[model samples]
Target chain A: MTDNGPCPLQRDAPGQVLSLWWASTGQETAMTTSGRTGDEQAARAERLPQRPVRPLHLQAGALALVLLGGTLGTAAREGLTLVVPEVGGFPIALSCINLVGALLLGVLLESLARRGPDTGPRRSLRLLLGTGLMGGFTSYSALSLATQQLLADGTVGRALAFALLSVVLGVLFAFAGVLLASRRRAGGAR
Target chain B: MSVAVFILLSLAGGVGAVARFVLDGLVRSRVSSAMPWGTILINISGSLLLGLVTGMLGAQLLTPELQLVLGAGFLGGYTTSSTASVETVRLLQQRRMVLALGNLLGTLVVGSAAATLGLVLGAAL
Candidate 1:
């Protein structure tokens, strides 16, 4: 038996050692192939050997955490809407809420990835905060509806601007968050 | 909002989030694509539903409070901008500029169209 291959002990081992090994080797293979093709990452990821399916109980636990986190996040968003005050009929509150959520999600995901692979506490936090809280806090439906309303109201220019700005700025903000986290890690390392 | 309505809204939001999570997972498992198709589908569908609700509100078929709960609370949680934005950024980081731009623009364009269709259909009803 090759000692380098995944073993039972390694599979059950605690902490980031197993994940690091998988990331360095397994993910490198996927990344390299996908990097070459650019569009085949997901297909390659699926074709690659996968980890064992998680137990049902663990999956349920994740769902429960998402539910709890989503509730709190939605409430927070609602509370903010009550006080955020719109500007001249523009959906400023909605835009700010979405931008902030996107920024925070970028920060949270990058920091967690830096900390370690997605497992144990890290996985829990990702589902709860990243998927659940931030997901709930931001509203794409509202953005779409607001744009539609603007167009219907004959302000086609404003409608187009709103839609474009929201999508473009949102992506930019997320990138900024990723840079912020990575820089923090670099500073800490130094 | 009243305390009761607030609680209901929050609960609805939780349900919507769970629905999004489940639907996304189901789609992801079935389809392997570099683009975040799951989020795109979710956002478009949620936008459609919200638009329908809005039309209903305009037609006086749904109460304002009910619209608040369903539109702002449920559909709001169901459709996520943050994930969509982050996924686009990730694509850009991977140097898939075309896919990144596609994901960003595609979602907005298709989602807006879906919302408009829903609104028209709902108003016609």
Candidate 2:
């Protein structure tokens, strides 16, 4: 990539985009209240972090990796669903897919970040794992729909249990992944 | 799921991920907010579509293969829980309690609501 330290554009920086918007809006309000004119406001905006202008090649490479990874992850999920399917109106297959994917993602990100500065190979790897594989593997939408369906069917207890478990397991697994990676790193260093 | 179905699911998933990436970027470019509207929109719409597909399949208005392709494959790739969870953690770290809570609660509540609406509509059809 362009070597801007792990390429924020490539990383799952959705939160970054949101926060940026909020910061800019707040800044604009401050500027307006301070009697700064349009020119002054523009000058202030110039100092903020401008969006990275990624080159065509890097963009294309990332896109290709994402597509490849997404295909694999989705197919894998489908395979699992085939074997497990839903039982008792509960989507055991989806739950397993999401939880496992979340754990893997945590490990992937932790290991990748610890490897070194996010540059050529590292960036590509992150794209393949974070954006492509995990992105495809763990689905928020399906989980929501499945939970909602249970709710619709008056299975309130089951819906709540599934939802709570997903969130709790997701966070805990991610933490475990980070811990495991750190331990590996420490051992390697020693 | 058959071999052909698996292949189709893979293709659909690739398309779905690309669609998510494109739509997220488009929203980010067009709108500025602390709320992460891009992801929110993506998750909500994906949930609705998945719910509809699930409903249709359940009602036998659609086939199982279609459900595998659309609901499990496309929607699965399109909406992401890992990223959402990580974002929530990041917000918490930044001490943006309101926004963090909003992101978490909003996604759950609104996404579930959208799915419910979709299910109702699909069942009605």
Q: Rate the local accuracy (lDDT) of all candidates.
A: 0.82, 0.74
What's the distance in Å from true for residue A180, model 1? Answer: 0.5
Fnat per model, in the order shown: 0.75, 0.65
Clashes of each: 0, 0
RMSD to truth, every model: 10.0, 10.7
Poorly placed runs, candidate 2 (over 4 Å): A1-58, A85-88, A186-190, B29-35, B56-62
Candidate 1: where is the Cα deviation over 4 Å? A1-58
> What is candidate 2's lDDT per residue for A9-38, written digit by digit as tens?
665364244234434433222313335578
Worst 10 residues of 2 chain A by lDDT: A25-34
Report the error of model 2 at residue B93, Å. Answer: 3.0
- The pairs that clash in candidate 2 are none
What is the alpha-carbon lDDT for the whole of candidate 1? 0.82
Clashing pairs in 1: none
